[model samples]
Target: MELLLKPIIEKPNETGSGHIKAAAPVRWALASLSLSMLMPSLSTSIANIALPTLAQAFGASFQQVQWIVLAYLLAITTLIVSVGKLGDIFGRRRLLLIGISLFTLASLFCGIAPTLSLLLAARGLQGLGAAMMMALTVAMVGGTVPKERTGSAMGLLGTMSAIGTTLGPSLGGILIAGFGWETIFLVNVPLGIANLLLAAHFLPADRPNAKTMQGRPDAIGTLLLALTLAAYALAMTMGRGSFGAVNIGLLLATAFGAALFLLAQAKVKSPLLRLSMFRDSTLTAGLAMSTLVSTVMMATLVVGPFYLSSALGFDAAEVGAIMSAGPLVAALMGVPAGRIVDRFGTHRMTITGLVGMIAGLFLLSAMQGRFGAAGYIGPIAIVTANYALFQAANNTMIMTDIQPEQRGVISGMLNLSRNLGLITGASVMGAVFTFASGVADITAAHAEAVAAGMQITFIIAALLIVATLGVALAGLAFARRASLLEEVS
Candidate 1:
């Protein structure tokens, strides 16, 4: 067991604190991560605001407009893991620059796209670029930062992510209303260019080991994984009832691909995904928590606009304002949450955050139709706080457990899990909304059915939160027991 773990556990020598420079490398990496994190949230919110306009411009149906959002997410989800692995096999910094360039180019294409199909394709490519940036940013952090200060640095990174999430919708709304839909993508152009230049100047070059450099990428495994993710994403997007023969086939293919991928990984000399990493209990639990939290968080993103707009009669700007509330709280809470995690350990923070999240969800579920816009203030605030604490805590926990060498793969996988969770939540909530609203017209029933559906979804999300709390408690207990055993020995 020790021999098996030895290769996995060995990490690069920590950079000396005194030698660590505050100049270009750290700044560029941080900048890149911040911008990359901003893209998804920005795109999601911007598109939410632009959906009506897009429909008017293209004569698109509601369902087709939904694709404008789903297409980008699917692209990110599909390519993230592969891109992350490539970062490891190739060079993290090199890939980061390439990703940024691709992202900028994609943004340009999206801004000028003539047709709906072209726009969707451009968005997909943009997602691919975003994935590359996301996949490498943290790994780059691990590589560049001194071990002693890594936690603080990551906290800062989390803060940037929180800010991005907060600003995405609000800024997007402003841009769309003031200029046009093109401004949304155009916004990324300058930011992406800045990130690219910074990355080129500051990010460290990845020096691959002889073995890694010589090793071939697992082409078969990559295809299988892509197939699996694509199928699963498609199934979720299509919804359960809407799934026809093709969707069913895709689901089956996903299962087959996943099975084959795992089998191949077990046999391959150099696997793309290191299955051995799952042997660590902390890593496993951290990944699980990340997935659950992301699912719950994404449910809010999917359902919040509908609840605000349809239920409360909020327009695009109003919806953006209401939606921005959570991310703002998240941004405020991120740094404190990270500091707390460092001092008190991840388990307590995770438990507390999960509990807060459950409370928030329950509050949301209890919203009355008669209640005005102000009535939702409490629920939204609580949800935002929960999001802040949960994200910071979960990230701290996961990164603490993994060795530096494995950071790229682990970070990539964690991100992939989060993306998958987001897609799942969006799809499930979409289905729920459709079913609930179909039974009651918005005019006749006045969002009661939609509220009911949202309540059920929130309840399910709350249950997941409870499950996370249970895991956190168990982990704490295990840690206590291990400490006692160590003392006794």
Candidate 2:
């Protein structure tokens, strides 16, 4: 609270553009936050490349080894809401420092674990840390930076994620090839420690939130939420392995668990999830748009690579190379996109982004015309660049409306929406491809079927983008109308 009490930059001007002050402290702040965010984002994608290596090392099937990835995701989704509340009550700086420490320790364990189960457990710890960092980093920056520059700050964070994810596969391959699988986890230790130090030195300290500091966390609500998110995530992640009793049971459990969480939230004294946050229609709209952007981007990552590998008989290396285009361009476009959002407003920029993304998807869908990997690059890059434009704007929209004290929770909610979108995209895209291709197994499917399936997936994603555009436009109109009514009254 004291740290926030003395903000580095004051409230932005009327237009909400962040003032560019002396570049030293602000630059360090931005770079530290960006790199800190990058570590967790990289971890998300890097492990996917290591799955085969892990399976072989552990003498496990593909299905069994998936827990490594799912475990991390499960941990984040379940604990993020509570962690956000903790940051608000205790202090974000304290939470983030502790989070980085936990993450580093877990990474060490992951490097040395002798068994698959232990590694999976360590990964869960890593996710817990990642969730804390993810929840607080945006809020910390939002509070520290001039309000007008908030969009640019988010753009920088987004750039970190884009770079992390984009470079992860390549980085994993090099590390695994050069040193072994252990190096992948080991690398995080020094980096995490260095980041922890930088954050400690540069990141502002936290002040206790009067609103939540004294209240006890809602135990029942927390448990119910954990069960709800864990079950839902597990079901989505493992659905491809076939709908067995465990998976089916999890789904059923998810339904009940969600109902219970809702009930618990309603009854709880100090809730983990503040349902009242949705009262801000602008924030609600921003959340929706964020989810849609995440879904479309993730689905593109999924089906785009699959199309190259399955339909065109490309190797993993070639597919990776082709798929890299999107994030590469996205990284380049992030800052400019953020500035555009600050200037033209999130509404105009979102619509622009959506239209560009839709056009790119259309081009990608037509890849059935014997296009090579190079052909795919253009469309992917275009769409990816638009992603930068869209997400930066959407993030600014969400953060701008949130109260400073509530930023921690709302930031968590923002990340949660994006994470859910990713889960949905991966699961739904796979299912749709399976059904459209009429293949029980993806690897065994004929080229024609796979191609058709990829086309259909892209089409579906494009349609969602269109729907997202409509929602943004409508929400903005409704917000404007409400403002007019209030003013008239």
The candidate that wins on lDDT is 2
lDDT scores in order: 0.73, 0.82
TM-score list, all predictions? 0.86, 0.93
Model number with the top TM-score: 2
> Candidate 1's residue-wise lDDT over 90-195, tens digit each?
7777888888899899999999999999999998898888788777777776666555444445555666676766676667767878898898888889988887
lDDT of 2 by residue, 1-489 (tens): 122112333345558887445444566556567766888988888999999999999999998888888888888888887788788888988898899899999999999999999999999999999999899888798756777777777777887888898888899999999999998888889988888887887777778888876679778887888888888888877757356788789989999998888888888788887778777788888888888878777787767766788888889878778778888888778777887887888878888998999998888887663557766787778788888998888888888867667878888888988998998778877778777778898778888898898888888888999999998888889988999999999
Model 2, residue 211: what's the lDDT?
81
Against the true structure, candidate 2 reaches a TM-score of: 0.93
